[model samples]
Target: MSHVTPALYATLAEIVPELHVHCVEPWCVIGSAAALLAGADVSVADVDLLVSRADADTLMTLWAERRESVYEPAGAERFRSHFARFRFPGLPVEVMGGLELDQGDGWKPVKARRLTLAGLNGLAVPVPSLDDQIRILESFGREKDVQRAKALRALASSPLRGED
Candidate 1:
């Protein structure tokens, strides 16, 4: 099962109250939420948020939304009868897929590596550099998953340099 903590969700709202943060995993709610507040492009789902670091914000408010037990993503009406969930191998990842954010270098995409993803108060959201995200996705053994992740990873990780 995917583990999404209540503190993470609260931290997300505290960080970004504006933008839509697309989520890859449940735990990454904090960083993706911040991305929206920071003026980055965002996508939101019931369980995850995808955003860029340049647009992400650090939380100033204490974690508050812990009381909310249900996270209802919009347009989930079709899934009402659903009950089971699935867990795939990879970063115990709060943030899974990478998104595009333009740093000084140019419009490029990045993701957080396994090492940098863990933080003290919250799991800092992350997206690896495009090539890096592809390399990382390639590392996953599931062939079908690799195909999908790599495509999204490539789209977000633009400004392709070496081989991509």
Candidate 2:
């Protein structure tokens, strides 16, 4: 399992201090990051934040000025709802709201209420619970996600060591 580097946690604490942040990607909380943080081996990449429409708008406005580049507009015609991808201080940041996930047969919208505050190095960042993560991962049903869900399930069954 790959652990979230102290540097990365520090960077997250600095930039997304108040926004509701969640690790929707496998890189941070599904492999090493999850194992390190939750006693499960999981892989994590960049940070994926599930923000409210208001918070997303606030981040869009803030990032638009500070971002190195705008990878996607907030309301691109290609997507069914609002989403934005950008680089903030060299970190890959993805802010999504009202976006739907491909559920094989159809699409399901991601809800913001699923996120709850979890402490990482004493900084409060929002993330889904283990059950929610597993459910979301299962809904995606990709090979990697299935593997991630398996790992997370094992971790969830065990007692957590301590907060990250």
Candidate 3:
């Protein structure tokens, strides 16, 4: 896997502990952030957290002051979640509760098929594995997501990078 940046690690350090404390259900980082943690070549604008609805509510209530009251996430038709955005010192973090994708047949929950822990300052921060991340991106089917999935596929097959 590629190395995680200090800035990103720092940001995670600030937020992840509280998540572990407050969120009772399973949770993990997703989107470009997860890809980045999995060693895929991608840029992360902000942290995308996948959580249960109850956890989302808990976090929303806890971080009420930092919540973006008027912000609405893009891709309303493509995705659904009990979503909220928060401002943090290192970067913005978005919480997606029970996120589901519109798969034409029906809505399918986006879940971590395999959870990988990316260590940060002794904290085992949960992120989806590279393969799982690829599957998710492909499921999204957006041009950018497809491209990221391709990149992840390449990284997974790279002789230079060993399997985790």
Best by lDDT: 3
Q: Find the 10 residues in a row with the least total lDDT in model 1.
A: 79-88
Q: Provide the clash count, candidate 3.
A: 0
| Model 1 bad stretches (over 4 Å) | 1-61, 67-126, 140-145, 153-164
**Residue range 4-27, candidate 3, lDDT tens digits:** 666677678889999989999989
RMSD (Cα, Å) for all candidates, in order, is 15.4, 5.8, 1.6
Worst 10 residues of 2 by lDDT: 23-32
Q: State the number of backbone clashes in model 1.
A: 16
Report lDDT per candidate: 0.33, 0.55, 0.88
* Candidate 3 lDDT trough over 10 residues, lowest sum: 1-10
lDDT of 3: 0.88
| Best TM-score among the predictions, by candidate number | 3
Per-residue accuracy of model 2 over 63-124 as CA lDDT, tens digit each: 78655463654324223445576654434566665556654556667553354455677765
Pairs that collide in candidate 3 are none
Error of 3 at 135 (Å): 0.5
- Taking the tens digit of each residue's C-alpha lDDT, what string does model 1 give over 105-146? 443443444322323244354333344444534443346436
TM-score of 2: 0.69
lDDT-superior candidate, 2 or 3 = 3
